[model samples]
Target: MPQPSVLIAGAGPSGLVLALVLLQNGVHVRIIDKERTHRIGSRAAGVMARTLELYAQLGVLNDILAVTSPFGPMASYDFGELVPKSKTAFLFEHQEPTPDIPYPNTEAVNQTKHEGVLREHLAKLGCTVELAAELRGFEQSAEGVMAKIMHTAEDGRQNEETATFEWLVGTDGAHSVVRKQLGLSFLGETRTEHVVGLGDIVVEEGLGMDVAHMWFINGKMILVRPDDVNNKMFSFLYRTSSAEKPLTREDFVEEFYRITGRRDVKFGEATWLSKYTPNIRMVDTMRKGRVFVAGDAAHCHTPTGGQGLNSSVQDAANLGWKLALVYKKLAPASLLDTYAEERMRVIAHMLGLTTALGDTNRANMGKKDFKMQHPDAMRMLGVNYRGSSIVCEEPGAAEGVDDPYMGGVGGRVQAAYRAPDASELVPAGKQDKTTRLFEMFSASRHTVLVFGGDAGTRAPVVKALEHFPATGVIHAVLVLGQGNATPSDAPSFATVLEDRAGHAYKGYDVDTGELAVVVVRPDGVVGVVASDAEGLERYFKKILIAA
Candidate 1:
């Protein structure tokens, strides 16, 4: 059978990630960008820990970390006097890493560099972003979508082209043509009253590169932080009601002196500048038939919490694997609906959280109310889809209640929750190497963690799963307790691992003598939690199509 083809609109981080993931899953993809040149400046600065975990799975976390720095030790200034107390200015508080949670802190890098990392990875997969190409319109039917794209040549000649694809995805920014064309309502309010000037600039000297500097004077706030590129370059955001004329380099310099009450500060050049009016809007639904929208195309929110790019890229991750499965005929088309069902909930809560943070920021302009801004929820590790249609939990499981932002109430991994990563697992009687749970997941297969019970209870579950090939849709992993011998009757298709430190069992909350199966989706979300073979069969029935 021919591989399914997908067209991704917009070459931002979201579009590029979706394309890269689809290509890795053996899907054909064509990515396009409306902008003639790539985006620049420190637009979205915060890369959440959850996003870093996904990047690790995609094998681009190291590349991204190479270009970024850890965010910390923010300093505040009041009326030209440095505050005696130093406080962290990030949106989320830092947590110490545990055995299950690997990345516990957020990383800071400008969106421009972030997109560049994704673009390079996409190129490695034999795909490149087509620049100066615009998606004019599209119409989708039962089988596929007919898209009209316009390409502009260097000679200023424009040519129209038509293409057909099995699916269409829009990662285009806030003013997404795909969303508008589909007539999906971008519903929400625009905070014009809270306008600010945001951009990157070159400073010859004066500001400390080690810490973020914030000056709150005359009931206005101006923040300056070192650019991820280098110390000589910095990014600034100044809140002002009057930006009647376009904000220029002179305007930023002049405003900086006025707000800081210091004549010694110097500005070399303003490489980029723009006005930001917070727009809180999102589509009612992320998908309509064969055409879909992800990232900024699906939702837009205040940049207070820095959830924009992370949320959008996650949307791509959630949709990419599902599309690949449907095309490969391993899953039914109904599996696609769960993307909208799951992401919409997270996006809606994210919009509210960021909006609240923006409001708190505006309220604390000249006050010392920094405590109201940062919260654990902003870390995004707590975000879950407990109510997703495809998430199957064992009978009588707690199934914890769901909150819009905090997710379910559980200390351990639950259905539809982000799968916790456990490290230092050793093969039975093998001492040479250690393995992590995350290494078992791939874009092409589901990871099934089987917590072995007694020989009597474990054999049936393992034997029944033997019918499903581990190299195919399901990759079964037999996790044995410490000092337990590998059973001779263990399925040949399964990969056996001994939890040397007991971290896997404790992290996953598996009972000592009860059989349990934790099925993780391709995107690393907990898909199904079952205790028996019949329960696992029901989950596959819901997602996979019968041949």
Candidate 2:
């Protein structure tokens, strides 16, 4: 029998990230792009601090981080040029909220730089981005999804081929072919006021080009970041003067002066300069049976606040784990539907925020004082879907209960939850205190989270753990108060660990008044936040063992 297939459309960062994440779990995927080559322009440059941490978790931290520039001590001025220097007048600073995870520094990485990182990562997974390929037709059934694709080779001959898989994903950008085939409606309005200009160019120095140089003037802006990967080239994003003017090489340079008060700067060779109407769009739906859409295919955030790339990458990460589980038959089909629901909800908020900020940019064109400084905007990087079916939120989970984003890497690795001795786990070779015990657990099997130390809770939890030993490998944990357990009494409570002074509960950042047990899914998300550990055994035996 042939292996399972995942047909991914679009080789942009999000699509490529999805393919790489899925491939890490040994899933077979074929990533396709309508463009014959990777885009080298600086389309999206703002990589959120949270996204950088995700990449670090994925094991590509050293490779990508080495080439990327550090964006700190940065400034955002109201009356001067927004250039990267040793010092600055305007401070558009972004800082990590929690010290445990400190890599939340977002530098200006162009789409080209990031795409190179993603492409390199994808290659390591034995998958290559297929260029000059387009999806023409596809169909889904109870069994799987079948895709009809057309490929054009170096010979320029177009060949039609068929790919059948249990699942198909549309990452094919705003004008997604996969989305169109699925008839998913892009439900949002296009903004009409300002024209967003983006291009790649090498400028003649002394216009103050020491660090990443940006000019915030004349109600317009230009972001010039260094891209050594492309021969020390600097990419730019400036606002177009009017909608009527067609963006050409000459127009792109002339407009920069008209806005920034500099006309003597000789702009070097040009790559791709696009003039967009700054539209915001999102699909009314993201999933249809075996077919799903992600990234711009799902929702197009206004590109002002830099949420588009990170948001898309987060969508891939959220859907990657679930898709891996369901594709492997470890979860029910209904669980796959949650991808659209969860991501659609997130992208909607991103779009709303980005649109509001874009309006702010258009409004502040004269003063040139456009700055995106929303703290809530950073929340997208750390989003988790406790509401999804695959996640079993505990009973009476508080309405609007903020989920502590924690997941184990299938081991005894500690989660960043507050531990009695957080100071002990600091320098374990790139390991931080944030590596929680939750992240160390293998999410492939439903792990039983036994909360309390009482006989009522421990008895049923132990029984279920033993019962599901073969059915589901259960990692029985005892989140007791500090000094609750001792080695001398180890045999009496064979699998119990002292709560470390109620530190585990506090560390995991969970409420621990009297909840007897909690069951965690393989993904380190709460599966069954048990009401009282009542019907607890049946939950394992009935809902889970059978579920």
* lDDT of predicted model 1: 0.82
Tens digits of per-residue lDDT for model 2 on 460-492? 445545544353345565544543433232332
Output the number of the TM-score-best candidate: 1
Candidate 1, 336-389: lDDT as tens digits: 998899999989889888888778767776775454376767678887876677
- State how far residue 397 of model 1 sits from its true place (Å): 6.9
For lDDT, the strongest prediction is 1
Question: Which residue runs does candidate 2 get wrong by more than 4 Å?
Answer: 73-92, 96-99, 208-212, 227-232, 242-246, 365-372, 379-463, 466-506, 510-547
- Report the number of backbone clashes for model 1: 0
Model 1 stretches with alpha carbons more than 4 Å out: 1-4, 82-91, 229-231, 242-245, 369-372, 394-401, 467-471
lDDT of 2 at 396: 42
Q: TM-score of each candidate? A: 0.94, 0.78
Q: lDDT of all predictions, in order shown?
A: 0.82, 0.62
In model 1, the worst 10-residue window by lDDT is: 82-91
RMSD of each: 2.3, 5.9
